[model samples]
Target chain A: MEVKGFWHWVRHTLRLFALYGKMDTLGLMRSMGMLLTMMLSDTVLNIAAVMGMLLLAERFGGIGNWSKYQVLFLLGYGGLVDGIINVFFGYNVAFISRRLGRGQFDHTLIQPQPIVVSLLTEGFNPAFGLPSLLPGTVLLGIALPHLVLPQIAGWWFLFAINMVASVAVVLAFQFAFGSLAFRAPRATEEISSSTMHLLMQLKSFPLDGLGAVLTGSLLTAVPVGGVAWLPCRALLGMGGGVTSYWLTPLLSMVLALVAVVTFWKGLQYYGRVGSQRYSNFGHRN
Target chain B: MAVMSAAGFMGDNALFLIDYLLRFLRVILFFALWRLILHGKGAINGYTLSTTLTYTLISEVFREVMECRTWLESGFWDGSVSMRYLRPMSVFAQYAAEWSGGVAFRLLTFSIPLLLLSSLMGVNPLPASPQAGILFLASLLLAVFVGLGIEYLFSGLAIAFRTHPWIFNRMRAAIGEILSGALLPFAFMPLGLGKIFSYLPFAGQASTPLSIYVGQADSPRLMALQLFWGVVLWLIAGRLWEKNKEKVVAYGG
Candidate 1:
């Protein structure tokens, strides 16, 4: 929280991270009970949240044209995206509206780092963040056994790229929504969280069965489809043909560009008006 | 609390607006998921699109008002639970009243309007028979107590947590979403698992009432089971409250 000069701040942050890393390693010795409790609880929550679709896939042999493994893969992708968000951003940074609404943006303004960099890094929680991925990574492993390799030799490489692009699409969208906090901090503060909830809730839907209009709207307007459906489609060879096979990464790149423009525009507005909201909540140290 | 909450919806709904929008999107997604699964089939294992739509509608409405989430236990988190102890009122009763009032308002404003609109659009949400309708109401009433009891356990168990009580709340909510059949009808469950979950306490919350509404559980046994879980959950909830009441008072907001 100290507003040191730029180089000093960078060095301090590195030192703090090294210390934090050591503490995270020693977390077992320091708070074994709490650590275990969190890990166990996170696993259960992650499984339960995705259990309904999985049960449907298991019992009914998957929804629509999707095979059980395909649905599992989609769930795996969503889980990994969520895991990535948590490990890097967690809810605090991922749901940036809260910090903005609470006038914590002022603290970011004071940091030697750029506001965007601060927003991106402030909520790193690697120690606790990795637990939610247990179910997802396990699911991915389960789905890997059923993988249908495309003729392309770079299938794994392509999937990895899609995964990275999907994360960019999600985080960038969150940033765009969170930027609204600059103008009307309270009103726009929860936009990111709400949209995140919307995305998470709808991301795994087997959207292949819907009509073009509905599917197209879901893919573009909301883009929950972009988060999982299209990516899974690409990976599963359901992208209609080669030209469409890379649709997910393409959509993600377009989304990332749109997100950047929206965010910087919001930042300019934020710089112009600043926040009028007041806060008594102690600054996070 | 119920009346005040009903009034508060009018008083301030800025927070709820976004939540409601998300719920609407979830409902649409639920519909789309079903559309995919049931396409060209007309019906699967006795569930038609209409029935499933009705189920989705009722599930969204009832859970929105009646089902409890982490925020329901905010009194504990914000230390307002201790203040309830200062009053002559029973904390459980107070929560029930608050929840009931909100439920009544939502059933009137949100549920009724939505049902009417959906009905006009050819998805009838009403019960198959008048008796079924009456029983659905009765089952729902039982669910109020069952849900409150469950919320009590959720809050009371986390009464001693030093950090991240919300994790327990999230876990409980996740468990409820699946087991309560609020996410989907237990009909899609493996035959054995469906029957077993139908007997579990969580089923008493969403599954039983919806079952009654759909005329799938007209048997006196389901009603009897709902009654059974109602009493058992409250008793356990009562025990948890007694053990944790002191812990609640230990921290005063």
Candidate 2:
């Protein structure tokens, strides 16, 4: 009875925390603003680019043996997935790294809460979703009918795999950045900015378009390619076999396991190395 | 006397040119170190290393040349504008002169070296045409004006929001960076989506000019649309400034 009660409380607390997280005012406002701006920018540029290219493609009679709609369909779904990630999971790695490096992790240690739960829930960046992505979601819904339903369901499953992968890989990135903060806090800031910049700039394009060598490296090594492209191919009912459909999620699970293990190892190193408390104005602990 | 005056003018021009060249060179070196991490590998949203870096270098030059610092907090707290308004010169004109000086300093120092490096890296800077060059310069100048105007106007939010102006400013900056085509090239998105982005001022700031120079835009008609949006944003900024002028506090520093 005691153990069952404890389990029930845990479940109740998780639900309550998630509910409160959704109510975060500042985060939501900021998200709204971001969504508005990104939507405006993305909407205009994407339309102009696709239509312009399609017109050209029509004249030239399609490049790479794909129809204009096929490419549009590819981009539309790719963008939908991209938008979801940017809205929800974008902050996870950066926030974790910043907190970990600052030894702000200690603050959470004193609380009677789970460390991971606190890290995810402590500060909400609602602005990631409200105005910006809300509209983008509408745009995405409009684009959705263009995709077949069963494939869309499959894509959702892939999205689930991608989310797990995101947590894993992003945790790795955070651990790597945070670990550097022990030696140099400012360095993490630089890394964060550049990584964010690179992801924003690079992730939208078709990975395969860059050709085989680069795509192969990204797929096997970094693995950002798997998040969208793998699922996208599955959704399109293309060359991706049943094996390919399962491949990304399987990889995601393995990567998550590896990342957690790596992070644990990194934590052990941190204990041994013992980070210094950076002081202001030449002050010392 | 006329010949001597002409020689003097030429000397001043040369000095200004040299200053600009030197600043451009320094910035280029800084950027080269910054971008060295990428090592020109990997594609960003369909832009190759060559195209991406070239676009980046151009945009960086525009940003550095046009940046106006302390437009928000200073205007609210320091009474800096009070002094400027009392003077004979128009505040806008004075600021424009400062912008010109900075631009001059950047062109000679940073831009030339970056141009050289990009050329060596096989990155063609822009399509070679007098008309294109003129259009590009004009659009960039308009962007600076629009950007500064917007910054200054929003900086006034410091009066109302108090102590949290930095938050708003950062938010604004982040949104602007993404919207402005600084984050990703505008060319690579879906057609419907790209249409929406082009309507926003961000594309007008970076993407449109770059696209025009790169021959990515369909026609001069699109360039005209870019100009139209720049004007509209400027007008919007002016309106916002007028609406918020009364909220300005004369807090002493």
> Where is the poorest 10-residue window by lDDT in model 2 chain B?
B5-14
lDDT of 2 at B44: 38
Minimal lDDT window, size 10, model 1 chain B: B10-19
Deviation of model 1 at A256, angstroms: 3.2
Model 1 scores a C-alpha lDDT of 0.74
- In terms of lDDT, model 2 sits at 0.50
Top candidate on TM-score is 1
- Which tens-of-lDDT digit does each residue in B1-253 have in candidate 1? 7778677655323544555666666776787777667667666556777777778778877875447542645565556767777778887678767767776776776666666676654567787689988998888878766777778777677765544456677787788888998888888787567778988888888988887787777458877887888898888878876876666533325
Alpha-carbon TM-score of each model against the true structure: 0.88, 0.58
The chain A TM-scores for the candidates, taken one by one, are 0.86, 0.67
lDDT of 1 by residue, A85-121 (tens): 7777753777867777767777778886666556555
State in Å the error of residue B181, model 1.
0.8
